[model samples]
Target: MDSLPNLLWLRSFEAASRLGSFTAAGVELGLTQAAVSGHISALETRLGHALFHRTTRKVDLTESGRAYLPAVRKALQDLAKSTENLFGGKISGAVTLRAPISVATLVIAPALAAFLESQPELNIRLLSAIWADTALETNIDFEIRLGAGQWPGCQAEKLGDDFVVPVCSPFLAKGLKTPADLLKLPRAHILGFDDHWPRFFETLALPVHSPTPSVTVDTSIAALEWVSSGGGAALLLERAARPLAASGRIAIPFKEKIPLGQGHYLIHRQNAPPSRPAVRVTENWLRELFGS
Candidate 1:
């Protein structure tokens, strides 16, 4: 038979290592300090290794204990989660999500109804912004941001490149022949994407110009709304434009897709894991939707 330490002893050892004090661990485990110490002592004897260094101020993990902690912690967490999955009631909680306004409007907002229908107990607080600060917001549980794949004090998961294409209404597109013809119509510009049109024209070997009667919007969704309404032509991010184009409400005037330096990223605070189990579920849903 394979030998295994008692589960009770493992619990005492893990708690002591995490709290750094046998008395505190005992209090947390609802046992006397002596019982906690005895459990760990018994565990160490079984394993033939000291799990912690005896100290006057506080107990410290021994080299052996340090090596064993990660496995023990993970095992305990897995067991608890499995128990909950099989027997626990539905997870009910609010999850705060922040993303670019364009993504929230066109992509996530449209699909969220079905997601919520499946988990009626789940409450999602979806927030949108035209631009995100360099730092991740402490209040947000998840953030889908648009930027370069690097942010200070953040773990940025690059989703996709910022691919954009010029789109206009079908009526407006009928008058176009080449890239330069885009200049003849009103050029709708989205704020915070100043480099898009300039780089696009420069790439196609045409001089970039801002024409009169042009409109500017703060969000890509706004630009798409303007373009779909035949307000003029606008260069839109692929993710934002996909739904409208597929519905046949808009037309892609050029085959050229300008690949920008920045793109969509899933943001997390550096060194901080999610605070709730619901966060993991919500993240998986978003990642699946984004096809990342």
Candidate 2:
């Protein structure tokens, strides 16, 4: 029993069983279909057990194979990830970070250059998508999330509050003098936040009505773009809209703003301890940036 089957054969068998196609496994493993088949056959011969039920169209894992597949797949993946961590290069590895597209583009992307300069060896892979509850578990090292500051099963740090105010293009601000004047100008809405308009109206002591908008966007950044392009006024976070305000593209119409909770947080999985570099860099940078 000292002479075990090749590790490559186990990898090929695991991939084939998981993917349900030798050809697909070959594509993933960078081997030919014949080579993958040979590896699986070799593993089966060594183990004296058929691992898969092969048919004309597909392959299904046998009971023994199903039992063995998870451990094999996890081992291989852990090996690959650990190898990347160990000898990848320059005492640096990639940090997979996730954030909303608006925050990523407006806030984080601008500050990234300075961070990169500070840590010349490290690499960052940024992912921007819709806010999801399960983001920390999805192969991401860190996530910048905007919500009510109540995320469970994650280590959380408050980034800042999201102060939302009505803003429009500098050109559109000509006739808009007060909150009452806002009723005349075309408005823009961000979907899934139906209370944004209502909250603003309530703050201004106006009755809630079905407000018509010139444009509706799924993301806040897009709404800002519309406002900047002279499309209409938008309710946007002060942190994100400040740059455009500085550039003379947009102007906040009202002095009174609605506090939309602590808008952003940096979160990571609670179960897994962050790597040394990840924790150090993230914690220091956030403290410097947000004064936390």
Candidate 3:
């Protein structure tokens, strides 16, 4: 009850920390950048520590800010959920969702504007994640993960499956007439996802040999960029590759794609169902959008 007066200031701090920009947080919170800065400054004055490292270009979280953010975010969610549950389930606050960078770019980013427009009262913060198995933050409301739909303590629902095909720039793809053509040319292996190159060649009944790649990358997005820049042929997920192919950035040399053993899923803690009707509705909307 003592901290109730500072609720708005806490929210401003959380938004700025999460977004990494005071201006961006201001836009989201419908406040002027100067006003947002004042709120943060006032909060910092009360807390007796700087929460952000101010820079000429952008703001970044200080060590103390990073430690405080999750607690603030969880408190906000709990308060919003409890209030909504008491008030007949009207969804009004934000939902924090995390997904892979590739998926965020390919699927959600494009559709998000219209979705937000339709649900004016609901806010969604979509964070780009690098790893599927990264530590699940206590404050995250939904996670879009790629796996067998079995998160330790979460309820997982399959969103969709994806497959990878050998792709290259239009100029490079022009020379490749057959699968064997890929073997002769330079190939860039996306370390984790393209470990199946040997198996794919085996499925084609070609003699299995260790492929010496022209280069190797850590993520599918980088591999796509490398291939699209005429770096070399590489295996990329069809969902990601198809758009690149359509946009003339890359081409699939063959229609055949190797099915990945895993799929994307929407997961949340099993013990903690979303108490807001709006959140539950959004969950249903995600299932429908992904065809679950």
The model with the greatest lDDT is 1
Name the regions of candidate 3 deviating beyond 4 angstroms: 1-92, 208-210
**Measured by TM-score, how close is model 2 to the native structure?**
0.63
Give Cα distance to truth, residue 178, candidate 1, Å: 3.4
Q: Write the per-residue lDDT of candidate 3 for residues 130-214, one digit (tens) a residue.
A: 7776457778888898877777867788877777788889998888888878787677776555376787787788764546677
- Give lDDT for model 2: 0.76
Q: What C-alpha lDDT does candidate 3 achieve relative to the native structure?
A: 0.78
Q: Per-residue CA lDDT of candidate 1, range 1-292, in tens?
A: 3587888898888888878899988997899999999999999999999999989879998899999988887877787767767887676799998998888988889889999897788899999988788888878986998777788888888766667888999888888999899877787777787647778888888886663437878877777778888888888877667677778889887789888667778888864532456776687788778764
Model 2 / residue 145 / CA error / Å: 1.0
* Candidate 2 lDDT for residue 37: 95
Task: Pick the winner on TM-score between candidates 1 and 2.
Answer: 1
List of clashing residue pairs for candidate 1: none
TM per candidate: 0.69, 0.63, 0.63
In candidate 1, what residue range of length 10 has the lowest lDDT sum? 271-280
Q: Could you give the C-alpha RMSD of every candidate to the true structure, in order shown? A: 5.3, 8.5, 11.4
